[model samples]
Target: MVMQTDTVLQKMSEDDFMAVFTLGRKLGQGRFGTVFLSVEKSTGREYACKLIEKRKLVTCEDVRDLRREIQIMRHLNANPNVASIRDAYEDSKAVYIVMEFCSGGELFDGIKERGCYTEKEAAKLVRTIVAVVQGFHSLGVMHRDLKPENFLFLHHQEDSPLKIIDFGSSTFFLPGESFRDVVGSPYYVAPEVLQKHYGPEVDIWSAGVILYVLLSGVPPFWAKTEKEIYQEVLHGDLDFSSEPWPVISESAKDLMRRMLDKNPATRIATGEVLSHPWVRINGIAPDKLINS
Candidate 1:
């Protein structure tokens, strides 16, 4: 069931609040907040409580961004592939956003630890992400930031479910509407985003970068500085002659090309990505090592 977004900010009685949940170790920190592992005393359920200091939101824009993140999270309730908010509380000092705890950690760490992934494994991971993108598109939500660091596995299992987190960069768009905000991580940012006009296709570009990195263990566009990286992205230089390229199938490369097309007008849609042969292939390799 979908939770009410407005009620999430309502102040409750002290007897029914913070005392119920035991905050644990520091999970991670972002630009404006820190996430802590929290557990409920009554049910023993675990959650990630994101604490955002009110003092940091010194301007109107800062406050709007934080509220946008919470609003987007609350609206996309109960999606298996997207993180859901369990509760939200605010005090004079900070705003606490309690969300589902993803124990398997960042997809970036998963990729880094393993070094690389096979086509089948990469396809499975991309499929989950594309499915979530499709859902969000239908709901008019745009996950402006789509990268390995934003995805997390639900458990420590090899085939655990993947969940997308960090909605601070997400925003809603109407049909045929677009955004001009130049937001998103440098390497994953689309050309149109740099041009200051873009739609949901920016996400497809970022996802392509993730797929490329999963198979090659590196980014498609890389340089020493953010400026150089953005320049490479604008130039749209893609390399497939590396060590791993010989092993990857042409179908996979084809999808990446379509996803990372310089023109957003011609980029592959999320629905098309899900049906691509590279993403649809499912194989059983008994000898393949399962890397979590």
Candidate 2:
């Protein structure tokens, strides 16, 4: 049945937020939206549906991203590392994006519970992140918002791979386009991005931050506020003495340092990430993946 819209705004989505959206409970909620653990009423298959109020949408900059996200996710659905959007629709008050549901919580919870990755597990995670970044670049799309919270879990038969979720912050930066828009979690942001000159390399920077978090069990730097964090990011601060990280490989540390470099022009090359010292330890290709 087509949705009834007798008195909704043109861009206004479904006000029947409670009456229509189906599946499970509220999983994550942010300033402008909420994601629910939902199921396709017909197929009974599970999905993570993020519901965003159309009127509450912030930033004219967000409009393009909102539309682009739908387009990009459609094109990127087959990639193993990226989450698949099962379906999407707009209602009288909000837009409903039904995406693949990953039962395991964000990496943030995992880190809190497990402390940090064993070198082996951390390597596996980083490889997955690198592979995803490589895939996105190949498609000309950039996930400007990559962080531990956006990282998810999915069982690919044997075990789950770290899946990248929440593309609301992603954007399509055309060739030769140096993005000046300042967005993304303060801790995972690239120095160049914070400095207002970046390209796809910023994704690599965020990926490197994820690697740092997994291996070191904390962000490279910590501060009391967003401004302070950005300042630390601007300066590219890394704490060698941060506890629980002494055993982290020097090569891994080298990779983080290069990935987090203050200069975008001098940052590690895209193809070189998989070959970095951290990714090439013990003469193996760091998980040697040909991820499906």
Candidate 3:
């Protein structure tokens, strides 16, 4: 399924990526790519280089999606909360994208290590996530996939800055525009996305799911199968009557309810979510930890 070398060069750069930077240990891997810790030859500065194999791009659509992702990353390069793309290069075999290296691991791993967080801590995290969503929407982009795994800390410090990664499923949109693609992780996917008609508000729903998981250590909608999970997401009620719920702050729950609203129109927007008392800085969310 490998594309012709000339064709790939037409879409990407013909220059040698290895000549400028040396690839180090493997950082991670995806369907069509492997991310490596790379160092620039001249400066010795470190970066993450995502090397997408041309052979795995089996179809024209796959190639288009990769290009779109690169463009989107470049578009949001100025945002401090986003992983900045430093450069892109391609050879006959692969496309290499150099980006900011996040030393700390995924937000999911961080949460797993901590077991659970206080309402205030969760609120602080959610505020950062929502701010990213708000910024993306302001720039006319919709982050079709918003999940904890896509968020990473800049360093291992407790107060390290959070940055959003993976724009592969993101796309630009106009005000009032609707997208029909059903793109997102199963647990975080909005009900409207399952129905095949949705907009940027889908990101809010996913963020709500993340918030819920952060406070409770589990997703609000859970089932043994993906189909059943979607059913729960579509019809199940929010379980504020559970164990941890009794101890969690009501202000946090109120914001959750509004953000996870099934109706996109009625769902709280990023601006309003940021302004919510529980989410705003020094707001009402308590510092007490929830039961693990």
Candidate 4:
């Protein structure tokens, strides 16, 4: 049944989600909800179900944000790199979003278990990530959070495709649109975001931070606390004089510098990032082991 709200169409079913799918195990939990491994009763297919409690949505803004998230996910349903929503069911007390289940685990975990990382591998991953950013920006959406944890491999295989899994902080945007809300993870958030005014460039900065961590195994801006992390993000220097960075190719460093530029005006655009020599498909990023 369709529940029409003022902001967006809530294509939510009033029936019980358990009637169609059986919840198996807890996958993860957040402020307002929990994700569970679920199995469809008819097909025996598995899925990740996000159950959001209506009671947790105490404020109107909270409800609006949840609706907006669903709308954005529906809007980006066609992108292969993003996790697709399978079905949405809402009852009196909660909303259940059934999504494509990713069993390969988080990107960083995959990287760590591999025991070896190279610039070529890093470039390939960054290419996919930047491509996702480019697709989102072209489609007028901005992913406020772009961190390593949000990317999960499709299966438990060496060659599994990476898929982005969160849209909680994402929103639609027009060209030159500036958002004032400071909404994002501290380590991956852009300096402009902390200042309360930002555009899609924030995504590039976050992706750049991820690339930095991928290469060096540490964040460019590190601090003991969230406040300190923000301070470092706003005022800290990009460290390339350290261990693995010394062996990393100059081209990769160049892309990082451009993407992490403090001035949003000078920050690399999504298209430019994909086209960069290091990030481009089969570009010049060396195959030498970065963590060696």
Instruction: Please write out the lDDT profile of model 2 over residues 1-292, one tens digit for every residue.
Output: 1134522223544344345447589999866669889866556677888887767665654555677777889989999878888767776556777788888777656545554335655666777788888888888889988888888777423366668887777887678888888878888888887778889988888888887776655688678899898888876457877665565566667777787777778888667877765674453323421111
* Model 1 lDDT per residue over 1-292, tens place: 1122223244532444477788899999999899999999999999999988767776767777877888899889868898889878766566788899999989877655665456777788888889899898889899988989899988877777899999989999998897888999998999999999889889889999998887777899999999999999999579988767766778888998999899999999998998887787463312233232
Query: Worst ten-residue run, lDDT, model 3?
Result: 2-11
* Tens digits of lDDT, candidate 3, 1-292: 6556545435556558999999999988877788999999999999999998888888878887888888899899999999999988988778899999999899978766777668888899999999999999899998988999899988888888999988889999998888888889999999999999889999999999999999887999999999999999999999999878888877889998999999999999898999999999999999887776
Error of 1 at 101 (Å): 0.5
TM-score of each: 0.90, 0.84, 0.95, 0.95
Prediction-by-prediction clash tally:
0, 9, 0, 0
Rank order (by TM-score, best first): 4, 3, 1, 2
Candidate 2 TM-score, C-alpha based: 0.84
Span of 10 residues, lowest total lDDT, candidate 1: 1-10
User: What's model 2's lDDT at 38?
Assistant: 85
The true-versus-predicted C-alpha distance at residue 239 of model 3, in Å, is 0.8
Candidate 2 residue pairs in backbone clash: 13-91, 13-92, 13-93, 13-94, 14-91, 14-92, 14-93, 14-94, 15-93
Q: Least accurate stretch of 10 residues (summed lDDT) in model 2?
A: 283-292
What does candidate 4 score on TM? Answer: 0.95
lDDT of each: 0.83, 0.72, 0.89, 0.89
